[model samples]
Target chain A: MSWQLTEQDLPDLARGAAVLGTGGGGDPYVGQLLARQAIREHGPITVLDPDELDDDTLVIPTAQMGAPTVVHEKLPRGSEPVDALRALEKHLGRAADATMPIECGGINSMIPLVVAARTRLPVVDADGMGRAFPELQMETFGVYGVPGSPMAIAGERGETTVIDTGADNKHMEWLARGVTVRLGGVAHIAEYAMTGAQVKRTAVPRTLTLALTIGRAIRQARERNADPIAALAEALSHTLYAHLRVLFRGKISDVERRTEAGFARGRATAQSFDGQHELELRFQNENLVALVDGTVRCVVPDLVCVLESEQAEPITTETLRYGQRVTVVGISTPALMRTPEALAVFGPAAFGLPYTFTPVEEAAVGTTA
Target chain B: MSWQLTEQDLPDLARGAAVLGTGGGGDPYVGQLLARQAIREHGPITVLDPDELDDDTLVIPTAQMGAPTVVHEKLPRGSEPVDALRALEKHLGRAADATMPIECGGINSMIPLVVAARTRLPVVDADGMGRAFPELQMETFGVYGVPGSPMAIAGERGETTVIDTGADNKHMEWLARGVTVRLGGVAHIAEYAMTGAQVKRTAVPRTLTLALTIGRAIRQARERNADPIAALAEALSHTLYAHLRVLFRGKISDVERRTEAGFARGRATAQSFDGQHELELRFQNENLVALVDGTVRCVVPDLVCVLESEQAEPITTETLRYGQRVTVVGISTPALMRTPEALAVFGPAAFGLPYTFTPVEEAAVGTTA
Candidate 1:
């Protein structure tokens, strides 16, 4: 399937991507603006389905890397992603026939759209991580043994570094993260360059359109005065994500959050509006685990999304504030993420939770909001 | 003015380079061992005078960047410098005609030797910094107009990064430093690629031979039971460093050092044996300022070297310990470093000291150890 994305679609797409961002990736507003500006100047971008890619097609994945706190303050110069892509192409001696989002969350999801618009390069409707993970190595591409170099990192003011640290993705992330802090807290990073064959094998397909659909569902439900949370759940059920549940409807009770190690981490507690059960959210850049009344309700690789109670707008971790009425929703992650191999990388153990992860379907089987 | 460096010279050269290293650049023992191993396998490395270069020769300066703590733990695989050099050559579409040390201190001074031995390429007898400075932009090459990229950095395990940050040396340092930490705390870096014309224009010429002379003087004085300080001063006078004086002779009473921002930085205080006076040495990678009883003594770009009183063995900042008897020597920096432009980058004020820098010749004229 091929779809053309218009400037009008950016808002819905960004909103839904933020919901999927799970708390990190910075706000998608700047990314939306950049994408719209590029599309306005370069015309609408054609979004290609992963199956549309010829096996020989070269695909490059790109996203911003750094502290979300920094990326929000210092928006990119818009040319950084393009600069990084060109640098990679020059190194590889072949042009990237198509571009893909490294992750389908927050600013990163929209950034590939910006690049696709500017370059007139069609974007594949897929992503490495079906949802954003704090570190680059936590992606499905890495889970499938894709190397993270010769990756290129581009600074806002023409600083570009292309590195190949062999198969060591953790080292690449460490190096890239440090450089991102030095490059004014955020930098555009393009890596995991793979052929179309590898793309089909490693990528979580249909994530772009999935993000748009998720966004449109919430938006339409709000306009029609329907239950947006239920709408969002229904929308996700039709996609690669099936298990969905509203874990809590509450007003904030207590919040503990600290931004460190290039990530915003800590826990948020939401007591029910009835002053009963409370949901505890533990996050590292994103909400990783959620517990209700000391029972593990949802864990990593199972989507734990927070949203405004009334408008249903997604609330990223950075914007989680005190006393706001919100709803916590849980969705099952993609099939690729459920594997023990993938779990080993982005699983609950990776985040140092006391209890191991249980599938959202199994955990939320009989639970009700 | 040209010489061949054999394995026999590694000890004296490493010692002398460590003295010039000020307090950072890591211990040169590992560098010397690697250089010696490369030379033992590939024969000797020929040293070329800067004046011997053809106008069209391509000269690339190589060094190591990271925390000394990390570097001390993770040793290089000996081939990283060569890999970085080859990567740079491939990027530039031209082979490096010759190599040079970016700084004539610690591991940096010996790394080019390793590369020269392996590649059988002659090393230019000059360096960018007459001594080490923590940041890349503090070098004379950058203080003049040479760009710091298209530079290359290589990891010990077949990882390589080539960048063209486009003449912004500070950003280059930030980007490189960030990557270095992720590269297991140490990475071989080759930067400031310049033409022979630019090299002659910006490099502190003959610093390699100067290191050899300084090394030979201290070693011979030790063998004959002569005053190595006086011999070192005499040898310095025979070169561009005419002003040399022993500033202090004391036992280190207090040493406050911390590794921060990828640099080993802190201050060391030495109290005189007779309790007559005390000297304070403040450093950022290299000793930047020396104060005698709250009066500014010698400031960068003047060399402030700490040495063992009995053996004249250089004591790097990481090795500075409490209650060790040591002598401090002050030597004038290169003429290139004395210019207003260069001084603007390395003077006392640049290091956040109270007063402007006074030349070592004027400051130490009437003072005696």
Candidate 2:
């Protein structure tokens, strides 16, 4: 299906984008504004599925690679992503046939639209990461063998760096970060070289559909004054099992932050169930694991979202703070993240959890359903 | 040259290990203890250069991949590396020709010896990182195209995982961390598929020689009652011109810490030079960069070292705290790390700095000798 960005798609896209963020994609507001501005200037963007492309179609998954917190204060200058894509195209000696999101979460989700609108390329309806992560390589696309280097990183100063370091995605992220910080903490980067066939092989097919449905669910919940959790559950009828639990309900009592390797590393302690329990959340870039009463209940690759009970809106780990009431929800990772290879990459232990292979259903079994 | 470990190697090894740690390789005490014990039990390890290897030889870089803090308390059962290597060999359906350290900093420097003594394989007198970094993939070897995954990750509990998510190096780090945490925050890992050609091409040639010399200089300094800085400067003659810089002479005032993505991330503000100067250090699995007076004085791939004047010993960022008189020194990165390609991966920008390369020499020409 062709995924065009109509005015109607904007709201759903923003809402869905936030959910797919996995509690780490930067504020969707900035990205939303950027996308809106671009759409208004250039009209709706066109999105295409991998199947719609020619065999040699040059598909690049573009993103922002540094501290998410930096992105809020250091807003994009409108031309960075477009410039990055052009730089990448120049490096490749061929124009991009399509553009895709590296992730469908945070600012990254909306970035593809901005790039696509400016570049006049169709935005792919899929992403590298099924959710957001802290680094460049933590995505479904990378797991499926998409390269992150040979990447074109563009700054607002009209400078572009085509990073092609072999196997060191962190270094690339590190280098990109310098430019981002130089550009006042936000640099537009376009990366991941793939042919249409390669994109079809690696990407989570139809993620745009999922994004739309999830976004629609959140919006519908708000419009009808319905329980958003139930709406979300209903939306994922086939993907999620019937039995899901609200693992803990509490207010954040403490948050500790430390920036390591330029990525935020921290933990938040939540006093929940009317002070009867405490849930601790650990993060590096993205929230990787959640510990309830000293036992790991949710781990990376799965979605560990902290939502406000009243509005059901996601609260990013960076935004989490003391005295904010939140409901911890754990959703099982998609099939792509559950494969032996994916689990080996992002499973519970990957985030330093002691347990392995316990589905959210099992991990949250004892919690209130 | 055939290298043999001895009681004399420990002190020097510790000193050199800290220098190689690049500021965040974690406490070397435990690694030294483990290596010393292993040496006492299994005999001194023999280190061989990669050039001596046969073209068909199998070389595995083995080390602990997890939080250094957790490693101190969760201590290994002495078989984690051996187990990880054995599992690796099993997966490869062959025996390893040799083993080597991924980094020469902290525990990683000694781990090669532990594995060598246990497996009866020679430890290569080279490493991936001349200095230590905080994650699995932020190494020169990784930049040289060493794969960090399809790794053999093992725990003392007999648990083993052969991770093969075909992502870049950082993803492997995340995956390894997940296992480390699953195993209670530490795991022995054997990763990176290296051909003999790669071993010879990328392994920091004769790093053990450099480590030994640095160690010897420290020992000599203590014995002769000479200045350790002078001794170290003399020891690092090859790279000293660019690497050595006295960046700060201050006492630590505040230290903030929080864990993210299985790493300790934080900054230690040091009060030095009769003024309040903050040396901001960021670490993942190792220290990646250092900022002095809000400007990046040194970035990754270069040596960012914090030392205590009392003994001229290197201090891990985790242990850095208030009341500690620290002399922040910047060691110029090797020529290999300064290449545009390398800079694209490990420069100031790579560490999330907003500045471009202005060698430590240029930045602190007057502040340092």
Q: Give per-candidate clash totals.
A: 0, 25
Give the number of the best model, judged by lDDT. Answer: 1
Off by over 4 Å in 1: B69-74
**Which segments of model 2 are wrong by more than 4 Å?**
A1-369, B239-242, B276-278
Model 1, C-alpha of A46: deviation from truth (Å): 0.8
Judge candidate 1 at residue B270 and give its lDDT.
94
lDDT at residue B76 of model 2 (Cα atoms):
76
Cα lDDT tens digits, model 1, B1-369, are 678989998888887888788767678898999998999999999999998888899998778888776678888878889899998988887898889999898888999999999998999999988888777888899899998988898888777888777878777776777777667667888889888998889899987777778888999998999988888888888888888878889999998888776777789999999999999999877788878887777888888888889988888887889999999888887678988888887777677777777888888765558
**Best-matching candidate per TM-score:** 1
Tens digits of per-residue lDDT, candidate 1, A1-369, equal: 898999999989999899889877678888999998999899999999999889999999889887677777887868899989998998888899989999998899998988898888999999988987889888899889888788998887887888777888877877777777777777898899999998999899998888899999999998999999888888887888887787888987777877577777788898887787878899888889888887777888888989899988988887888999998888898889889989988898887887788988788655546
Over A154-265, each residue of candidate 2 has an lDDT whose tens digit, in order, gives 7665655454544555445544554354445567788887888878887876666777788888878888999988888788775532334577788889999865545677
Q: State interface RMSD in Å for all models.
A: 1.5, 15.8
Give DockQ per model, in order. Answer: 0.77, 0.02
